[model samples]
Target: MHAFRLTVLAGAIAAGAGMAAQAQPATPAQLAPIVVRDAPHPLDASRGDAYVATRASAALKSQADLLETAQTVNVVTRAEMERQGSTSVAQALRYTPGVIAQYGDTDVRHDWLTIRGFTPARYLDGLVLPFGARGYAQPRIETYGLERIDVLKGPASGLYGQSAPGGLIDMTSKRANGERVREIELQLGSHARRQLGFDLGGQANEAGTVSYRVTGVGRRSDTPYDHVDDDKAFLQAALAFQLSPRTRLEGTAQYQRIVSDGGGGAPALPVLGTLQPTSAGTIARSRYVGDPDYDRFTNTQTFVGYTLEHRFSEHTGFRQTARISDVDTDSRRVQIGLMASPTQAVRYAWAFPESARAFQIDNQFHTALTTGPLRHRVLAGVDYLRETAHFTESQLNILTNASGGYALFDPYAPQYGDFDIATPPDGLNIDQRRSQLGAYVQDQIEWDRLHVVLSARHDRVRLDTHSRQAAGTTTDANGDINRTTFRTGASYVFDSGVAPYVNYATSFQPVPGSTRTGAALRPTTGKQVEAGIKVQPEGSRALLTLAAFQITQDNVSAPDPQNTRFSVQTGQVRARGLELEGKASVNDSLDVSFSYALTDSEITRTNAADTVGQVGNRMAFVPRHQASVWADYTVRSGPLAGLGLGAGVRYRGSFFGDLNNTHALRPVTLVDAGIRYDLGQASARLRGMQLALNVSNLFDKTYVANCLGATGCYWGTERTAVASLRYRW
Candidate 1:
């Protein structure tokens, strides 16, 4: 089967190239092209743009055409996200293939979704964001400050050390581009939401050699879940300077504060009546298990980074980047246990407080040279990361084994007694220090229509953890792990714009923990084999891609089948899938995107000693079949020339909710719509202004997202509508 697939792929490439060559007249002017165009608005989002982005930088360390990258890469452009009125990074990726926008539909707290069957790491720019591995320390990137989002599917440990095997999502931040721009927006939406945002940028020096950009967003709102609030304040500033013709310097600083941000909102509550029928009655989606007095959550994060670049010549350049990050969070919530009886349940108060301080640096050197008829672009780089953190958890039992002290509650009719709120004492404290050092090399070899990429990386990872119990006695768990990963791929780009490619990549992730006698186990290893074809007719804005892949992961950490409390690294998972996607600027007035994915993911091996009976079950939260289509249209020339309309449909097939495959999550289909009008059409004074409105889950269809049996389940997001007015100068 593998040989046949490769044979067919090779034939397609040859035929495409042959047809293109015969169609285009061989001209000297075309053979030696002049005026190569730079990527269109790749690092900037405020300029004129389209839904389909032709280039991405995440596939390779440098910006390159996606057709020849030989990877399943998706870019969610700023224009596309803005048109849909996306409020979060996950929302922006709704239409992309293989990305589960909302894992269970209601995890508004963190970006808790999967890419290609697994939870992917979040990246800012080309570097890891260093979120804590044991706490609720995820970064909540404000979409308003982003230039774009690039998703690289499959293993990438060859370049990025210790990555999520399913893939990685990198957010490109907005930067100063020496262009005059000013924008401000006001928005109103569901849940009594109100928001204000602004982006202003321009040259800092008359020579246009220096530039600066400032972006900010502030909002306050109530959530559909009673007593929970959605509030945030964020600001980011970027400054760039062209010190010399071949050297440049850029710096950025960002600060964000969030209260009850889309995190842990679902985990704090218990589910019942929603899944089936409970003796208490059906629980409305608006049910809040946390008491208003203890429902507080706060996260404050700050980051500063700088980039220095110098070009020795047009063919060679070196760059170095460094960043410092500090994050802190404090949260309090009331937890509800499964119904003890038909009308009563146990409740408790819990607290999670954590903080982290981190530093990271990366240095790279890249050069291009030609040897005979082959063009080679070689890249060598090294990076280092060091992070120190304190993770703490506290609880006060209210009901039995529960906490702020466990109390008895009735779900059918809720009540918070007048008893004074109790404070939970820290029950567990963990101080951790983690670090990693990695070096990698990559070479892109090009000859005629054939492109080959080879890359390898090695990393040394160390973890030191100290745990303190309620008695104040502390114990340490420390270990060091080392691994090497690699990737190899070859692609053929036909003159007809057909590119067929195949690649194999491996991943390495150090499992954090110690064994019975304080020793490190093995790291989790993963490998993937991918083959795909990408077609983008010459001089066209449309791209169509079809791909098939298989991935296997080994050494997964699980509990000991022999001892439920101890862990062992003897488990495996396999995922195979087919994906089809198309994006295009169909015409001056229309833009469209569509995608379909069929994922077959299952647990292949287990330490039943460890996993109970989940060995052969499907991975939870991942659907077998998913598909979506979206389109936007505008009247280019007419009385309605400034009016635009958009609509999208998304479908997710049924899947299991538990590792044992007991709970079955039903399939669901959702619709989204948008409308925008250029206010300038009504008055010349509003030439640079616009007004827009967007609605998601238009029908308010309710569905179960995740299920853990009769004990609990999750609810999908409810209908949401927002309107905004914006002006740009």
Candidate 2:
């Protein structure tokens, strides 16, 4: 089956390349080349004036043309996000290729997504968010402060230490870009949502050597889900200074706060919410199943960072980037437990309070030189990360007494009480600190039409954790480990503008657990081989990529045989897939993006008794087939020349909901559409005024978005609409 898929992918690539070659005749004048010594980095081109990007830096950590790189990289420009009226990171990624956005459904606390069936790491600028491990705390970033987002596909541990094999998402914050910026926006939407925001930036000094930018947002909203209200505020400021022609410095600071009703509560039965209405008196779609008194979540985050760049010589340059961040969250909610039948369910109170402080630094040196006919771009870097986290949890017994839950009441008519629970003491569960230091080197060699990239890195990681108990004594769990990772790839560009490439990369992630012998287990390791074709036809603003890959992970944890409280490393998983994506600016009036992915993910081996017979079971939350298409059109050279319209459709194929393949979620399709009118050309006074409206799930479909098991199912969102008015200069 794998061989057949590969053959089909290859044939598609060949046919695409041939069609591109035939579309444009190759003439001497059209193929004429020009070389300049002081051209700007390719990354600068990706931050273009439009929505279509042709270059990115996330894959190589340096400005490079995407067509020349031997990997898949997708760029979501700020223009694209604004056009789609995206309010969250997950919303911005909905149209991106090869990404499963908002798979967690109504969980707005974090931007949950998957890349190629695996969870990818999150990065701010170039530093890792460092969450999702034992007791690690991650911050939810507001999308209003971002300038752009870059998605790099495939394993990247060879450059960035300890990352998932699938890929990573890197966000670039808004900063002073030397262009004057002035914008103000007001938005109103369904569920009584209201927002006010502004952005202002320009030169800060008469000498033109200094610049500054500031962005702020305030929002108050309620979701379609009953009683789930959200209030948020965000502010960001950045400054830039050009000390000299060869030296420059930039600094940034941001603060954000969010108060809301706790995350979404899944249904007690997988089939009750969508497949059938709850048995208790017509469960309205707006019913609130959770307690309104105990449901609350609050989070606060602060970030400060700086970047310094200097040119030592014509052939060499260096940059240093550093950041310090703090995140704190407090949450309490009443969650539904196992269902007794269709209308009755057990409930329990849950609370969690966590805080984390992290610091990171990266120093890199770059040199571009040539030897004979081979041109080389070499990069060497060192990075360090330090994070400390404190967390505590408390549970209220609410399963035995009638006051604890609605044992038989209707789900649509929830009852609430004033009973209050005491907050848990800090450090009652775990306190941990993690530190990592890594050094890496990479070289990109170009000889004619062929390009080769080689990179290697070594990381030294240390963890010190203390488990706390009510008896006042703490147990220390400390460990240190070292690892080496590498990556190599080569690509050749043909006359038809098609580049065929192949790559091999490795990744490692530390797992927090012990064996029966009281020894820390080794980190999980992953390896992958990917081969693909990339095409960027000449004289066209379109890009196409076709790739197939296989990934294997070892040292996965399973239940320990000797000790029931600990775990052992005796499990493995394999994921293989094919992806095809295309993004194009077909003409001055039309733009389109499309993607399709096929993922086959399964647990290959394990020693745990519960999973011994489930080696072939499909991985949880990952669908077998996913596809999406989006297009926008604007009237050109007509009376409605400034008017635009957009529409998209997303499809997710059926898949198992659990690792054991015991339950399956049905396939679903969603539609989205938008309309906008620009008033800039109408009159001098209205030159910068515009109005737009967007709708998601236009058909108001009712379906199960995801099911963790028989008792944990999330309903997809119903139809939603947002309208906005903005003025910009």
Candidate 3:
């Protein structure tokens, strides 16, 4: 049987088992039970507010307990991030299954993650961050302003409109909920890193009708690379107002500025200096591959958004959300040219001035009702997105030797001179615009232990591109694409607390170009089938889940066989995988999070004679096996009471570097450890004080993190340590 068929068969068997267990006669509820009080805070009572989240809203855009949803989704709560000292998305998802965080390690400025085998879309509070850094730079969100991060695995276009086949990532922002909140933190770390951060929030009036929150961070650090530094400042503010018992409105604003000499790591070479040593002497891990004078990236970003929601009676509600953002960037870099020899290489430089503006809005209506013996919850929404960007690129005149190109006698010791590099009169000037309108509807139905989900969406997308030059403005590409997608799933739960589920989903992405015949190409489409089993023992906080999935993408662009100069849409790729996750509290003092994944990806079909024979090759940068485990323990009673310790291990299998599979990367394993002490238990004066230390790559093991065929390879983060002092009220 085919792999897809096998997956379906397994799901059938699992579902049959669940049905069999449900057939047993109903039993009376047990009378003897002990009641335990929970934390007083509302945040602590909500789902996903604890380290081991049992509920999430990302998968279905509604709060649903994990076992009730058919898809595989994981939520990383704020408490987990604090224990790990995670300052970025990459660090927060380091232990998650089916997510490859920082796959390109070369770009430290961005959260470069690949879910399953493809790049997942990014969302902030359920709104898409369209395009990402594909053309222009965007602001990096501060972790201090986030309440949780959710990863929804597999195709989600049925609701999100445009998405990758792998999955989607959604971040929930921190907002005031009428509770008094105050926190301040100071930190010191390796590389002369220093930082300060604060968060404040409170209710404005005694009636608790108005609430506000503010978060900010400032940091400066010298990186491991020579002449490279990281500096940034960020601020975010939010306000909430309850006009009446049935109506609520919220507003948010954020601003960020950053200046950096380089992105991350040492400049990468080919296999040399990566898998093998440089022909010259060993290449320095801290080598300055770019000119210090010309290498810099500066950016400023601003965002404003609002959300309004109203409830009518007990079963009807409406919500509207809108956001707009602007980003401006100036970047210059003098990079290493092709190596002439082990010790010699040429140099080139380039600069870019870019700006982008984006706007988005979503309106939704939700209702709950019953039809006969079945209960139904329905959601209908309409969303709109508009984005425009302007960019210019300039390069140095290497031939003139006035300001460009360099001749390095020894790569280790570089020479810098006045390189005449500037934007030419005929430099490239590009203006691009994109707009999308989408409508979607979803219905969730339940009867006793059986539940079902169905959803559909339609999208109309327009793309326009123009080149502004000395002569005139020329239209590069302009077209419109329309698509409709769908998703359906079913799950059944047994009295024993075991749930078996299966789902199928479709996705689509608009392409902006034309085909060999000058006809606008259609959107790329993907289909996936997934099945999983979830176990949550009754009366316990422990959870275990296992899932299997297969996905195939079609309408991929490839070289036209009939017309050598054009392209066709006859390409296909397939990915299949198994994932396992377990979260449990071994006791009152110990908690563990563990996960593992096995993925197999391949380019099944394609055009072009040069690549036709390479159809079976594995996709690049996708590890076949990956696993991680983390454990946190606190001393409840002892001389060392109030002390907490955490440790983790992460392992990734080797992977290929390019489509041709010419270069390979070695597998690696890393260790992390952290320790913290709460001073509140020691004295009343220090009631809200705490001190903590965290270290990653504890062994300082040096390894090649990743490599791009023609670009460069990067070394993983070395041993690093940080100490923090925090106070809260």
| Each prediction's RMSD to truth | 9.2, 8.9, 9.2
lDDT of 2 by residue, 456-548 (tens): 999999977776755675666678979999999999977667899999999988876567666877888999899999987776777798999
Q: In candidate 2, where is summed lDDT lowest over 10 consecutive residues?
A: 12-21
**Alpha-carbon lDDT of model 1:** 0.77
Tell me how many clashing residue pairs each candidate has: 20, 0, 3
Q: Show model 3 residue runs off by greater than 4 Å.
A: 1-49, 102-106, 132-135, 263-266, 395-406, 416-427, 467-475, 514-519, 558-568, 611-613
Off by over 4 Å in 1: 1-48, 102-105, 261-264, 267-271, 279-281, 399-406, 471-474, 561-563, 608-611, 708-710
Off by over 4 Å in 2: 1-48, 102-105, 132-136, 262-271, 275-283, 399-409, 424-428, 469-475, 561-565
The lowest-lDDT stretch of 10 consecutive residues in candidate 3 is 12-21
**Model 3, global lDDT:** 0.75
- Best-fitting candidate, measured by lDDT? 1
Worst 10 residues of 1 by lDDT: 12-21
Estimate TM-scores for all models: 0.92, 0.91, 0.90
Instruction: Give the lDDT ranking, best first.
Output: 1, 3, 2
